[model samples]
Target: MDAIDEHIVSLLRSNGRASFSAIGREVGLSTNAAAVRVRRLESSGVITGYQAILGTDAPDGVAGLEAFIDVRLEPGRDSEEFLVWASGTRDVLDAVHVTGPYDYLLRVRVRGTAALDGFLRLLKREAGAAQTQTRLALRPSAAGASARERF
Candidate 1:
């Protein structure tokens, strides 16, 4: 994928339901061109499935818990292999390689404590995570808010 494809992916990540026409306008492409690119991305497995997010006030399922987990891989484990697993895992919203005690930091959302426990077990069993430290997110920063505005 090129720069235009990267931009298209970013637009879709922010709003998966955005129309091809809207994406085309943002990326300086024709509607059909945008559609073609999106189709290519889907076929290439870069664009996964999309889903609806129920609001907190909604009468159905409760808003999920968000947390960050610092992961240390097992001895002689492959970082690339772990990354592949992280990318495919549904609850792992973001994974970053960072300079720290841990090899990676993952941002995730799950139903509740039981679901969180299950995910942790899966991470250790399937992803080769040797150690992990977790922190619950009390709240997220406001969208489009700058550092100065955040405080």
Candidate 2:
């Protein structure tokens, strides 16, 4: 993408709801021009989709506790099984197959400690995770804010 396209992406990343006019104002393009560029970005798959970054108090907010669970699969167990389960499971925000001490890293969100405990229990029982190390996330920050501030 060109510089202007990159700028448009940056603005959208910070605020997906930004109007085309606002983007034009910031990037020195007319509203129509901005709209055309944005449409191109979308059609080209550069702009996949927009999403709201809900706060803790949102109705379906991620305001609860977040944890990164490093999972170790049982010997001879297939990692694909766990990956597929995680992909379809609610509350699992992300699951990444990593090369390290753990077989996979699961990013999970829950309402409280009790909920997290229950989720972990269910994970162990059903996911075929032989062992896991859970680390609680502290004061998660927004990626958009950081990028905006830097630029």
Candidate 3:
């Protein structure tokens, strides 16, 4: 990618919905040229599907008291089984299968402690004798922690 392509991507990263014409003007190109370039980038996999940045837009069927549950499953248990179980649970924001001492790291959000407790129980049962580590964030982590940063 050249300077113009980089500039276009930078702008789009900030706002994926930025108009082609607007980006074109920023990079000194016509609308059609900008569209072509963007399509080329997408086709080449340099530009993946455009997506909106979701802040606090939690998924459906779940609510409240979100926390990071660092989990360590029994050594012999199948990790994929744990992940598949997680995939079926809507309360899980996401899960990371990591190489640390902890077998799995989960980003969970629930209506409250009771829900969290229930979720933990499910995790323990599904993971086959797992140890849980939970953390509740009292407040949003410094809202926009990366709001001010250089690219």
Clashing pairs in 2: 56-63
lDDT for 128 in candidate 3 is 60
**lDDT per prediction?**
0.90, 0.88, 0.79
lDDT of 3 by residue, 1-151 (tens): 8998898889888878888898899889999999998888889999989853323445363446769988888878887888888888888878998787788888877877777888888887766636888998554455455756422
TM-score, prediction 3: 0.53
Query: Considering TM-score, which of the candidate structures 1 and 2 is the better prediction for this target?
Result: 1
Q: Which prediction has more favorable TM-score, 2 or 3?
A: 2
Error of 2 at 14 (Å): 34
Model 2, span 1-151: residue lDDT tens: 9999999999999999999999999999999999999999999999999965433633465577888999998888888889899998988989999998899999888877888999888888999888899998775656568777745
Better of 1 and 3 by lDDT: 1
What's the ranking of the predictions by TM-score, best on top? 1, 2, 3
RMSD of each: 15.7, 14.9, 14.5
Q: Which candidate is the best by lDDT?
A: 1
Error in Å for residue 85 of model 1? 0.3
